[model samples]
Target: MNRTLVRLLQAPSIILLLLWMIIPLSMTIYFSTIRYNLLYPERSGFIGLDNYRFFWTDPSFFPALTNTLVLVGSVLLITVVLGLAISILIDRPFKGRGIARVMLISPFFIMPTVSALVWKNMLMDPNNGLFAAFANALGMQPIEWLQDMPLFSIIIMVSWQWTPFAILIFMTSLQSQDKEQQEAATLDGAGFWSQFYNLTLPHLARPISIVILIQMIFHLAVFAEIFVTTSGGPGVQSTNLTYLIYIQSQQAFDVGVASAGGVFAIILANIVAIFLIRAVGKTLTV
Candidate 1:
């Protein structure tokens, strides 16, 4: 009776979760098979795969896919490398380490919109932005970071916001390190680099993989920061697949095309996720 009651109580929550998840996705799939444009309402007709073909044939499509891959790869690389270094540095007991950790992690707490806006107006501005001013002061050419390198600018912004999460994860992983092992290595005159490569890094392999998988999943859908900073470009330069979908849905007001693009994105993300899971099973598992 008790088991039955527990199952009965959970039924509502499960049904609600399914509804929340399925409705929008179902709508998108249905719409993708139709030619539904808000602008061309009178031309409604069944155009199975036509929307998909149109999106795939777009000049911006391939570049958007490449940009997403580059962004995810670069951000994850920066986060892991920098995160490992800082985690190790701060793992050693030091004065004011608590306060420093808080400062470092605080950037991750800032809203992406706010972060991007401040970066655009306050930092990346060519005329009076902090970055340009500093370069000018050093007798270097003030770079128009966003205008010249829109995609790169967004990558830097994302890395700044996310690297701290990686640091925290690595620091937590480091806490479980066996100090006796380090002492034994020291006795054998194995310097810090040798110890880290053979001992610490091997232990960190799992959390490092976890960080990469998790960061890649989140970064694949990075939209707000890119939207706020670049508005998808001076051209299509900064438009990732997500932004391309946004342009289709909103600017172009083509629901069918947007849904088709979204379906493609879903497939791409799922493919990456499946590969990561397989990697974990093959390499990380016992």
Candidate 2:
């Protein structure tokens, strides 16, 4: 094939992808600068920074941001710790390890929406859910999990779905560990804890940072669980930035505010990405 033809063929795919991403992003930025309201679309004008100002001043915005941080941070912490312990355990050849691995990995394959529904209606529901049934049988009150603990419920739901992913990454990283180093440490009378902390953990530093950053990005955009379960309800108590923007655009029909919120999310994600890249650069050189 001619080089020009080959280049032309690849150009279409790149162009399509760019258009798919950039068009919507540009639209969002344009709307964020206007006063677009679905109910009164004709009245929309260049509001400049009014929508951004209102969104920031909204009392719910700060709480939602805090909740967003907590949701992402807590899940990241849990999944990393559990993923490390599980990876280490399974790295050892034990009986039935295959079965355990299957079970551990299966959760990541479940659709997020389906997992959210299962948790909302089956696991965490206060009425007739498994938890509620067991609590009622034990003569205890069925706590309103989604209502009283909306953010926590989301944390558990998202963690359940994503922990398997963390495990897979950690296990892949662990498999690359220097077994000779571990053996040498063992011969040196270094106990398991000391060896793990000194050798294994240091080896995992790059991957741990990778996992934390990647997972933070995904967790920041967590939507299905919060949407299907709480609908960002209990008075927006569980509304993370994603859900907050969703409610603004979909329910409240405030496209401008939603766009502004989206810009905020992009800014925050970039900030974390920069930190992660710097951390990776430093650790890789060391």
Candidate 3:
């Protein structure tokens, strides 16, 4: 009777979760198969795989895919490496460490739109931004970040926002590390680099994998920073798969093609997620 009651109480949440996920996914799949356009709703009909074919064959498709891969990869590398280093540095006690940690983690809470806008106007602006002022002070011409280096700028903004999350995870993981192992290594004259390589790194392996898995999932769908900063402009140089879908649905008003793109994105995310989960499983088990 107790077990039955527990399940009965959980049933509502489980059903709600299923509906929350299934409804939009069903709608997207349904629309992806039909010839639907907001401009010509009357001409909508069963088109089958035509939308998928068109989206696949689109001129911007490959570039968008490549950009998506590059953005995700670059951001992951930056955040993980920097976060690891920062976390290790701050793991030791220091003056003002509490205040420093609070400041570091604060960026992760900022909304993506706000972060992009701040980066675009306050830092990356060619004429009056902080970077430009610093460049002028150093007797160098300020580079147009959003215009000339759109993808890189987006990567920087995203990395800044996400590095804090990685830091938090790594720091928490470090707290649970075996101090006896470190003491033994220290007594054996294990230098800083040696200890890090042999002890700290192995302990951190799981946390690093966890960070990568979570960040990979989020970064794969990164759109707001790009949309706010570059709008995927300068001739699709910064366009990723997610932004490409937005262009299709919002700018082109092709619901079917956008839905097809959405399906592709979902497939890609699932593939990456599966691979990461398997890799993490191997690491954890070993």
Candidate 3, which segments miss by more than 4 Å at Cα?
1-3, 275-286
Listed in order, each prediction's TM-score against the native is: 0.94, 0.91, 0.94
What does candidate 3's lDDT look like per residue over 186-255, in tens digits?
Answer: 9999999999999999999888888888888999899899888899979999999999999999999999
Off by more than 4 A, model 2: 1-6, 136-139, 275-286
Which one is best on lDDT? Answer: 3
Each prediction's whole-model lDDT (CA): 0.92, 0.89, 0.94
Model 3, position 1, has a per-residue lDDT of 64
Question: For residue 130, what is the lDDT in candidate 1?
Answer: 98
Model 1 — TM-score against the truth?
Answer: 0.94
Which is the winner by TM-score between candidate 1 and candidate 2? 1
